[model samples]
Target chain A: MKLETTIQGLCASLKSARAEQKIIGFVPTMGNLHQGHLNLVREARKKCDVVVVSIFVNPIQFGPNEDYDSYPRTLEQDSQLLETVGCDYIFAPSVEQMYGNKPRLTNISVSNITADLCGLQRPGHFDGVAVVVTKLFNIVRPDYAFFGEKDYQQLAVIRQFVRDLNMPIDVVGVPIARAEDGLALSSRNGYLSEENRQIAPMIYKTLKNAEQELLQAKPLDEVLESIKVALTGAGFIVDYVEARSLELQKVETFNQDVVLFVAAKIGATRLIDNLQVKYIS
Target chain B: MKLETTIQGLCASLKSARAEQKIIGFVPTMGNLHQGHLNLVREARKKCDVVVVSIFVNPIQFGPNEDYDSYPRTLEQDSQLLETVGCDYIFAPSVEQMYGNKPRLTNISVSNITADLCGLQRPGHFDGVAVVVTKLFNIVRPDYAFFGEKDYQQLAVIRQFVRDLNMPIDVVGVPIARAEDGLALSSRNGYLSEENRQIAPMIYKTLKNAEQELLQAKPLDEVLESIKVALTGAGFIVDYVEARSLELQKVETFNQDVVLFVAAKIGATRLIDNLQVKYIS
Candidate 1:
């Protein structure tokens, strides 16, 4: 597997692959790889001739008070994990390399869709995601880009970005990979203490129970309230626990595809997860 | 010349052109087909094997009160003129074809540069231009895209967009094409009465005089004030008359490349023109 750290290097490599008419698949991520990110790579490997993974812990996506500085940087282990997963190229650019000495002046914004969910708490977070992903998409020019459903709102935002801009590439979302206990695998999960790690599974458990209740035709509001109460009762400070359409739009009644999203703080680490449930009437 | 009104047809044509390794040049327009738009095609023809021109009078660019509805749609004449210019393809898509049935939720915005000039008077105009141009760029995937410098701010915004977004295509700015009387050619010129048409030359004339004044080392502010006063004195409602750097940023000194821009209303028609002057000192 080839490792590229500069934009020019990666473009040159991708250009050669394009010359051979290779179908490129890309998975962009921040370093400290988990099973969820590798799942996206495995999916890409199955469907594409080449798979390129980018590991740049984007600073712009983090709020001023967010854990940007403390975000994990295990490049050595991350590289080994990618190699074992049969990844083709790893683009791990430095902060200075991705964003030069000056701040970026361009921004791509998706409206309405970004106003709800995790967007309400992390202002400008998705805008950061939108801008960086736009740059990466241009740089990679992959035939298919893979994004994990773990960040469901982000997947929806990216889909909207591609649709709105008429981008030629396709966006594919893989299901969220989880721990055996149902805790959605996240890089931030490493911040959890031993006891907090044991309790982290409660978040996903509550979501699964809510999905079951939804299947039984329980009231949407009641299911949401019970999920929130259950998480709060388990000592997690719940940020949001609500049901939304697959497009992340607010739905009055759950008669279609809906995802129950959850964000909560257990100990000092914040964790987010969601489960999509189809309603049959 | 082949005319394609649908995105799929144009993409297929351009895709075959790409396979043959032909260099494609694109000129995007709203299509009343004046000398200025033709000049862009001519520039494209000189440098590329295929020249595709798109005539889309984007609705999103125009404010609710602006002349979007009244914008010229001279498809028949425009097609004939493009054929005469040896253009390979003409992409004049309908509003619905380009934007679909629903409003576009995605927006591409360039900061700082777009906050001034025409962007100030026509809010969200550059955003509309950015979004549509982004779409056209992706669809055409041209090796080179051409723009007339008469809309200097729009040209600057596009260049910024390409650079910021890392678009693979190159943006080339052609000099403004003018009539023998020195009036810059524009589709909106069709709105001018014969009497207003005669007075329209004064806009370019004033810019040229301002350029000459700046060449004589006159203060930038004095030159700008005089130009605005001259246009207003000639029965025109001056929208803005200012000097800016090539990037459309405010210029406090005349020691670098500067463009003198003017927008004014003559009778019921509004006219805009610009002249670039290089500073020796």
Candidate 2:
């Protein structure tokens, strides 16, 4: 298992592997490796000749008021966990090394789709994600790249970008790895207060209830209203409870290609979750 | 020479070439192949084991009122020209084939540099160029890509984009190919009347005179004023003339990385040109 820090060093290592026609499977993440990230690495290991897991807490992706400075930097633990999971390389680059100078530009932005969801809440957030992912995709040039569906909207946007730009890599999306209590694993979960942490599971529970209600042919709007009621009842500030197309970001009335997405503020910590619904006649 | 209109066929051909460790050189053009495009193909043949040329008159780069429909479609002639130049592959895909039912919603924008120059006059022009270039780059996956400095600003923006995004491909800037009369080769030249065609050489001649005058260490503003005077006197509508950094898009003093860029309207035909100048104290 090689541990590299600079882009040049990592490229040197991968160049040799590429010469041998080795298929590289990459999982790019910020360095707060939780079960969700490891799950992506595990999936990569299962499919490719070489596995590269990059831990870059890309500053560009964080907004000015976001937790960029306070974002987790547990590199040592992340490296050990990767090694335990039989990972081939861990690329840990400094902010300067990763972004040489403030990138003078941004890349492929999905329009109104992103404009509403998390995009509206965190302005320029998806732009940062799009730019950094493009940079990483170019740097790695992996045969396959993995992303856990824990960041569902991100997964959708990236899929759109890869197809839009015709980037030649298989974007393998793994299912969201969850805690035993059904809470989706996230790096931000570490910021949760002990009391807020107790209520985090309810977010997922509300989504599950919405899914069950929709399964009974409840109107899409009514299902959303019910979920909003439940979340607000639990002392949460509901950002939005809406149904959108899984592939396209269109607001759906008939529930075709629909995914119920939710975001709420639970005692100062913003949490998000979603459930996929297959609408049937 | 193989002619492929589908992405799959091109991919297969390029993939086989890659397996043989062949260097693929790509020249992405907009189909009405002139002497300028032939020069690119010839250069690719000289330097690379395989040459791939893509002819896509991208609609994204054109303004709402621009000549998307009137743009020349000389595919048969273009292929014959490529074959004469020893080209290996020609990729021509329809807009529908290129962008599926749900076009992937990603943007690959260059930056502030592009937003000026042609980008300023033709809004979203560079964005379209960036997106299509990205798509072509991915599809061809060429080791080296060629661009004509005839579209001087576009070449500079692409260079900046590839550098900033850390994209892994060598971008070769080929000098503008001109006619004996010093008129720059452009497909759009066909749109001009015979009288306007005769006066087209003035665009190049004016820039040359500006280059000669600037040898006296004249301020850029003065140089630009002189060029604008020469252009307007020649019955041309001068759009803009300014000295800007070749790397950075802002106005810069002499001895910096700079190029004198100009855009003008000759009758109904719009033309752009530039000259790189050095300051010798």
Candidate 3:
């Protein structure tokens, strides 16, 4: 496996791959790889001739109060993990290498998709994702880019902008990978204390319950309210528990496909999860 | 020359060009078939194996009070003019095709460079230029993109964003095309009356005089003030007469290359022109 740490090295490798008519697949990640990230790479391995995984904890995506300083940087171990997954390249660029000393001034924003969901709670988050992904897509020029459905809104925003900007790249969304206990895999899961770790599965459990209620054609409001009650009662600060259409628009009825989204804080770590309800009625 | 009015048609042609290993050059303009626009396509013709010129009258760039409705569009003349200049394709997508009924939510903006000049004069103008050009570049996948320096600040913004976004494009800035009277060629020239057109050359003439003063190391503030006085006395409502470094930053000394920029309105028609002073101290 090749480890490219500079944009120059990455471009050179990509140029030769393009010349040879290789189908390149890309997975961009923040580098504390777990089962979910490995799953994305494995998916890429199944389809593409060359798979590149970019491990960058984008500073611009983090808010002032968010954990920019404490984000993990285990490059050595991350490289070992990716190598086991049939990855061709690990692009791990330093912050300076990616953005340089100057502040990034170009903003690639998607208005509607970013107006709600995590966007409401975290202003400028999706814009950060949009701009950074644009830079990565241009630099890598991948045939296909993989994103996990755990960041469903992010995937939606990326898809929207890729179409809007007419960027010639196909975006693929891999399903969310969860533990046997139903806890969603996340880099921040490392910050969970022993007690909070045990309770974390309750988030997925509640989402599953909400999914069942939604599947049975339960009232959207009552089921969503029950989710908030269940999580808040479990010693969580409910950030939001809401239901929207498959398109992320507010759902008035369960006539079509709908998704229930939840974000809540346990102790100090915030966890988010969503469940899509494919309705029959 | 082929005329492609849809993204699909343009992409198909570009795909074949890439298959044959042809280098593509792009020139983007809003159509009125002015000498300045043709000059840009001519530059692309000399360097690239296939030249694509896009004529898009972007609506988002126009402020509500500005003349989006009155903008001249002569596609027939523009196509003939491009064919004469050796252009390979003329992409003239309808506004609906370029941006669907839905609003284009992506904003590719350069903040520092766009903070002054026409950006201050016309809010969201460069951002419109930034986003639309981004779409065209992706659609064309051009090896080299050409711009006329008649809109000097617009070229600088495009260069900065292309660099910032890591887009693999070589941006070539062709020198401005002017008339015998030294008036910069522009599509907006169609809006001027015969009497106002006769006086419009004053904008360029004043910039030439200002360029002489800067080349001779004249006082920056005094020389700029004289430009405003001369144009205003000629019955033109001066928008701004200022000097900036070649990098588009305010200049305090003539120790480096400097450019004098001017914009003035005569009888409701706004005309802008600029001159560069290659100073050696």
Candidate 4:
């Protein structure tokens, strides 16, 4: 596998790949690869002729108060994992290589989708995500880009962006990869204390309970209340538990595509999870 | 010229062009097909293997009170003009084609630069411009994108965007095309009354006057005030006339790369102009 750190080197490699009419697949991540990320890479390898994985801990996505400083960086282990996944290229750029000396003044801000859910809690997060993804998309010029639905809102926003901007990229959403205990796998999952890790599974459990209630024809409001009550009952500090249309992000009766999402704090660490319900559409 | 109204057709055509390793040049315009726009096409023809011109009268760029309703739609004339310029393809997608039923959110925001200039008069105008341009860049995937320097702040914003997002396309700024009378060419020039048209040259004349003063080692404040005084004295409602770094958008001394820009209203019609000054760098 080829490892590149500069844009020039990466583009040269992609250009050679494209010249052969090779289908290019890309998986963008913040390093410290877990099974969730490997699953995205494996999916890319399954679908495309060449797969490239980028490991850049984008500073822009984290808010000043968020885990920017504490985010995990497991480069050596991540590189070993990528080689084992049959990845073709690994792009690991230093911050200076990606961003110049001056702070970049232009930024991308997604509206409607970013106005609620995680966007509401961490402002400018999606904007940062959008800008970096745009940069990576341009750099990789992939035929298919894989993202796991573990970050449900981010997936929605990115899918929205690719459509709205008419970007010539196929953004494919993979199912959320989970740990043995049903906790949604996240790089941030590493930050969870042993006790908090035990409670992290509650986030996904709460969503499952909400999904089950919707299946029973519970009113949307009542189902939401029960999920919130369950999470709060577990001593978790709930940020928000929302049931929104997977496509429109509007409150909907459980007769259409819906995603029941939850974000909450267990001790000092925050966790998020969601489950989709394709109701009788 | 190949005429495509849907993105699918355009991309399919572009794929063929890419397989041949042709460098595509793109000129994106809200079409009224003024000489300023034609000049961009002509420049694109000279620089690229394939030239694509998009005639999208973006509704997002217009404010609720602005002239979106009255915006020109002369596609036949526009296409004929583009054909005359030897443009390879013309993308004239409808509002529905560009934006699906549920429009995906936009993410391009240009700040501070938009704060004091025309943005002051038309709030959210630059944001709309940035969003539309990003969409165009992604769709066209041009090797180089061309813009006229007439929209000085817009050129600055887009330049920053391509840099900040690390977009692959090189943004090339062509000098502002002008009429024989030295008035900068704009489609909005169509809205000017003949009486206003005659006085429009005053905007350019006053900017040139300020450029002359700066070259004579005059203070930035003195040069700016002199231009404002000249325009207002000429029965024009002066908007703002100031000098800023062409790159950084800060009020810079008369020591380096700076652009002196002005905006004013003659009757109800507003006009803008600028002069780029390269001091001893």
Model 1 chain A poorest ten-residue lDDT run: A97-106
- Runs in model 2 lying further than 4 Å from the true structure: A248-257
Please, what are the lDDT tens digits per residue for candidate 4 over residues A185-227? 9888888889888888977887877777888888988898888
Tell me which residue pairs clash in candidate 2: A107-B107, A108-B106, A108-B107, A108-B108, A109-B107
Give TM per candidate. 0.97, 0.95, 0.97, 0.93
Error of 1 at A40 (Å): 0.7
Compared with the real two-chain complex, what DockQ does model 2 have?
A: 0.70
| Each model's lDDT | 0.89, 0.86, 0.89, 0.87
Tens-place lDDT per residue, model 3, A42-68, is: 999999999999999999999999999
Better of 1 and 3 by lDDT: 1
Badly placed stretches (over 4 Å) of model 1 are: none
What tens-digit string does per-residue lDDT give for candidate 4 at B174-232?
99989988899988888899988998898888787777887888898988888888888
Per-residue CA lDDT of candidate 2, range B56-130, in tens? 889889999999999999999999999999899999999987887875567777667777778788988988888
What is the C-alpha lDDT profile of model 1 across B200-231, one tens digit per residue? Answer: 89888888888889889889999999998998
Question: How high is the lDDT of residue A124 in model 4?
Answer: 86
Model 2, A192-230: lDDT tens digits are 899988988998898888888888887878889999999
Clashing pairs in 3: none
